[model samples]
Target: MLSDFLHEYFLKLSIIVAVFGGAFLGIGIGLVMRAGAALDGIEVLALYTLKRTSFTITEIILGINIIIFSFAALKFGIETSLYSVLTYFAATKTIDYVVEGIQAYTGVTIISAKSEEIKHQLVNNLGRGITVYKGERGFLPGKFDVSADCDIIYTVVMRLEMRKLKNLIYEIDSEAFVFANTIKEASGGIIKSRVKH
Candidate 1:
């Protein structure tokens, strides 16, 4: 049996085995879900609970996992249960990463006086599409009565490109106010550059 084989060979390295095994299992399950298929009854049960209860799918699943692990701890030794918990945690995180995507996207907002130059450079250098919003600036304690029009630039970029984007923007305007948010999902935009072979 698989259990016996793992116990015989990996008993001493249980933690490592659990983590790797869980990661591989999570990848498989995530890919199946992404393809619009169910891998186990837990997913089905979660879906059923989702409609009748106010709890989200993740909450339902977590609740179920807690119950299952509690029972596991009661039946198995504490050490075994702890290893199982580690495996479960790794698997859950791996599943999220796999399902969401390895190449994460970040939504960036830039507020700058040199908006025109920054926008041009962003498009020409980064090949990213930008959305501009007209807004008022200079709203300080004493300057609340006075304001100036400005352009707020927004764009989505891959996580790997964040440093480059920051450098580029700061190079253009040292005083540019920039912030970013982690995007769960992004679509229907010029997200990918058009590459020619």
Candidate 2:
């Protein structure tokens, strides 16, 4: 009877450790959270990587989750892998929503014929500074026509400002080629003016 109790207790303890350990390691990526605890090991690793590198916390978490889930799938089965992926996503989203709200940034690039007008609007109207790179565009892959010189207007802005900026871009130059990418973070620039225009 005593031996049976010991065996059951050990088994339960092992299972508990396995489950909780995996979940905590997989989820607690963004370190130093609300419950008054400093990060260690994996959580700290993720947080540090996020701060120093271009990767976001969510991305780092997802990458780790994928690695763990891959190992589980190979050792266990496909069902476990799918379940783990879903669990990671749901937990990541919920935790991020509750703990750290989404940090959204957009990198806007504009190539326009009317560079002066666009620059004026972006500076005076939007109160945004832009970096212009002189480059040759208009070289179609299919055509042999020579390229035309244009200024590559690049700026990083809050996602909320994208729509307004886009409208202004189109209004200024209907034929402007504009593209945007979701960036992880932006710093050390006149990202936004304190004095609203």
Pick the lDDT winner.
1
Clash statistics: count for each candidate: 0, 0
Q: Write the per-residue lDDT of candidate 1 for residues 4-34, one digit (tens) a residue.
A: 9888778768878889988887788778766
**lDDT (0 to 1) per candidate:** 0.82, 0.73
Off by over 4 Å in 2: 1-41, 45-55, 74-76, 91-103, 194-197
lDDT of 2 by residue, 27-103 (tens): 56433453534355545666778778877665676678788889989989976686667666655555554444444
Residue pairs that clash (backbone atoms under 3 angstroms), model 1: none
